[model samples]
Target: MSSMLSLRNVWVEYGEKVVLERVDLDIAERSFVSIVGPSGAGKSTLLRLLLGQEVPTRGRILLDGVPLKPECGPDRGVVFQRYSIFPHLDARHNVLFGLECAAAPFTGRLFGRARRIALDEADAMLAAVGLGDSGHVFPAHMSGGMQQRLSIAQALVKRPRILLLDEPFGALDPGIRADMHVLVTRLWREQALTIAMVTHDISEAFTLATRVLTLDKRRHDPHAPHRYGATAVYDLTLDRRVAAETAHTASITIDDNVNN
Candidate 1:
């Protein structure tokens, strides 16, 4: 395992309003980290910066020590709350689309053995996310959780070095949310994925993260950079890992089937 992501002194601002300030973090070879904060606290902003969708107003981000580029790549996957799948395309085709785009950007197609491998890869990804038999179904036929699962598989089909997820489970029911948490954690561990997600759920933060980061849009300290604001990083391996994956470890003791 090797280091996958690093951010140093990153600052993001929109016009006169700065959203994030001097944020530095390192997500190691195999880790799941979450950034949790109040709304308008620039949690999504941080993920955008990492994905190279938004350039830092001040500092820079490095993926595996390479300066963050200004575009997305196969090595950097993102599974957002909104599934990017085309409603017309079936599940396998949707995942295949990402693989085809990434692994074959120019020709953008696979033939002979390559075609078979690509389809197989797409099927495997779908299976990993518990959509094993849904390859032929369209997005319209799926539930919110299923669509989100499809989104994750599409993003991971390219085997991204870093997984950037923005509130991936927000739309699911509580039961589904818990199950998705376990699904993602197991994926991260088994695949050695380096993930950084933005979430408001503090218990979710503790459950899924190897570390937790908090962003406060309110500038309270004079040294807090007169720009966007201040962010704090917490080493949560202790507090978070102590909570086993058992259902008893969850903060909300609701009996309602969450994923339903």
Candidate 2:
């Protein structure tokens, strides 16, 4: 497992306010990492940095040992807390849209063999995320869990090297969320994706991540509470067996659904 991404003494600030400070981490290939923290702890900020949505005020972010550019690219994909799917498009088209946007940015359309290939890929991606039969339905008609699965499929249609998730299951019911847990773990394994997820649920973080990172404001100063920003306060590498058990249990849950 070589390092896929690395943050070296990263810092991010907006105007007079600081959001992150001295954040250093190395993310291995095919690793599932979950980030947890209190409110105002800059968890989203970290995700944005990785997504290349925002550049660090100082320091560097590297991918494959090269400095990462400060912009989103095909190499990385993201699923936000919100469904992030278009209401008008059906599930299949929603996934196809990602391919079109990436392949034909100016016209936002795909044609000929490229179009057929993308559509075929989209169908496979939708089915992989457990929405094979629902491709004709719009997001508005789908349940909360289904919409989230659609979101995941859209991100994955591009076959990104890294996947970033922001509270992907926060809006679902408990049972649906559990099913999603299984779906996501299965996708991670089958696709060999390097994942970085931001989740407020401590239990969810512990359950899904091979590595857990806790971010918080680490420096305390009586003069200015906000002067210092958040950083990785705790990093835990779970035992291999624990992660295996979680994936195993989630698989059983998915199997039960099929039987039912």
Best by TM-score: 2
Q: Please give the CA lDDT of all the candidate structures.
A: 0.79, 0.89
Q: What are the per-residue Cα lDDT tens digits for candidate 1 across 39-101?
A: 677888888887888898888788778888889766788988877878999999999987787
Give the best candidate by lDDT. Answer: 2
1-260: candidate 2 lDDT, tens digit per residue: 99999999999998777889999999999999999777788999999999999999999999999999989988898998788899999999999999998999999999999999999999999999999999899988999999999999988899999999999899889999999999999999999999999987766777888998888877878787767899998787876567655745644543353234
Off by over 4 Å in 2: 243-260
Angstrom error at residue 70, model 1: 1.7
lDDT of 1 at 65: 89
lDDT of 2: 0.89
Q: In angstroms, give how far residue 49 of model 2 lies from its true place.
A: 0.3
Clashing residue pairs in all predictions, respectively, total 6, 0
Off by over 4 Å in 1: 1-3, 218-228, 233-235, 239-241, 244-260
